[model samples]
Target: MDLAAEVAALTDEFSGVVRVDRAGSTVLDAAFGLADRRHGVPMTVGSQVAMASGNKGMTALAAMSLVEDGTLSLGTTARSLLGDDLPLVADDVTVEHLLAHRSGIGDYLDEDVESDIDDYALRVPMQELATTEQFVTVLDGFPTKFPAGERFSYCNSGFMVLALLAERASGTGFHDLVDERVLRPAGMLDSGFLRSDDLPGTAAVGYVRMDGHWRTNVFHLPVRGNGDGGLYTTTADMHRFWVALFAGAIVSPETVALMTTPRSDVPAEGQRYGLGFWVHASRDVLGLSGYDAGVSFRSFHDPVERLTATVAGTTSAGAWPIARLLEERLVTTSPAA
Candidate 1:
């Protein structure tokens, strides 16, 4: 089957970029639809798009770097870093729990319980949440849902706390720390946490369908991203991130192993939760995915096959169809029984 041709045929149905690479060789690279409808700018291979929650892996790597430098440990309590500011959060919730999604803390933007992404509203105005410290106000008022080391719960608030911890321990801004300790080492020069309100010309404008009309997502998300989500990157840069990660450039091999090791089951998603990456145990694939009002992304690396696939979309649900098509092709072409 001509997978590339098939993907190309579906261009009109999706809006984004798709890239597949095997053994360091490009297999498929294509872009579709308008990046900025108002300006008539088409999506390009170099166009940067938001990765919603997809950036959690980078945040995890930043924290691990601090661990390597002896500044923080996985067992460090969230309370120690945050102090009495957020009294509802339990004192037993440790860094490890947050990384593995086992903290069971009340999520400010809970995905599991919230069926429709559009129905969920932010308590704090999006513009006010420009920094990690500013997010604490909205993160308050929610009590801990369960014990610290309990079962996994995908909590966006937990990761915001992680961003706070990273800043406190490293004495650096969360964005700068990730750029220095993660993106620079991983050769992802084009990737960073960018403010949605003021974006560069190369950045894609996220769109969502509302009342049969397309609208921008500027008001749906925070003005700036925290640790939990919101990083702008290109498809090539994302592929570079995967390659560098597997090559042990961003984090130590031992640390990567620890981070990617499956620690809890995410039954609803039919996957397992690792430190910050999603694990497909049978296929030995590790990945990061995200979905917001007008952003969608999926990127995965198959270590056994030395393959990497990425799909980044500019609309709410545009990336999934293309990603599933690529997954189908991968399964059919797999060497394993």
Candidate 2:
């Protein structure tokens, strides 16, 4: 890929970081536009940007790690940990089904139903969503969509339930456990869930275009990310994560294989999906994609070639144009419409 040229072509639409790593060395590191528009702080390669649902892969890794250690099993039911919390989840919904998106559980953020990126989707205030335990209130009222193990249905609630299960199974906070097992071992020191209200100097502020003006997305998203999304990471850290995952540092190679094995074919998306990661239809690339009210992000890695490419943008639609450039060059010849 003409990484520089492709990124430059989307200068007007893309406003974030793009990084590519090859053979364990940085091949491309570029940043554009503003990280904080009000203060005029430019986005940089080091700026930590939110990954939205892209971090679902990390959540999957944590769950798989628990399974490897016998703390949980693929057959373990969400009800085992949930007790009477979400009364709508089927008793037969297993961890594996959840991981593979076949749990048939109703999603709180149903992507199939919700089309507006700028809409106020949350029922409660954003501050009330700081902890996994607090999310149960919002997850309520949704009915089960299908029988457990019925079919592949991308679910945000499935991952949230996994986060809740992870907390109960390990007796550790979801953030701490992910850091301990997924980030720390992978050497991703630049990544973590940060409070949207009190962002650090190194973090990027997500922006939404409102009535011809730009505003921060502090109200549209949760204060702190949960199982499904809302984690901030840099391009470099993402490359490290991919390398570490493939090198058997974060989890066993066998476990990694299981997670990346294609479980369903999502033709609407023109790709396949594994347990927690988006699978390439005709290539060896495993992908991560996230799109929220103010954040857009995607990462694709080829284990055989040791290539990792990631793009993150502040506006929800900015990253995709650049992502298509990368996808066309590295992922597949027939891109999804």
Error of 1 at 122 (Å): 0.5
Candidate 1: pairs in clash: none
Q: What TM-score does candidate 2 reach? A: 0.97
Ten contiguous residues with the weakest lDDT in model 2: 328-337
Task: Record all residue pairs in model 2 with backbone atoms less than 3 Å apart, i.e. clashing.
Answer: none
Off by over 4 Å in 2: 333-337
Q: Write model 2 residue lDDT over 1-337, tens digit each, in one string.
A: 3668867878785679998877778867999999999999989889999999999999999999999999999999999999999999999999999999999999999988957888889999999999999999999889999998877899999999999999999999999999999999999999999999999999999999889999999999999998999999999899999989999999999999989999899998888999999988877689999999899999999887777899999999999988888877765642321
User: Each prediction's TM-score against the native?
Assistant: 0.97, 0.97
Model 1 per-residue lDDT tens digits across residues 1-337: 5988888877776778899988879998888988898889988888898999999999898998888888999999999989877789898999999999999888888887746665437976788989888988889989888998869999898899999999998899998999999899888888888888899888999887888988888888998887999999988998899888978999889999999999988878878889999987455788899999999999988887888899999887889888888877774357851
Off by over 4 Å in 1: 331-333
In angstroms, the error of model 2 at 19 is 0.6
- Candidate lDDT scores, in order, read 0.87, 0.91
Model 1 residue 274 CA deviation in Å: 0.8
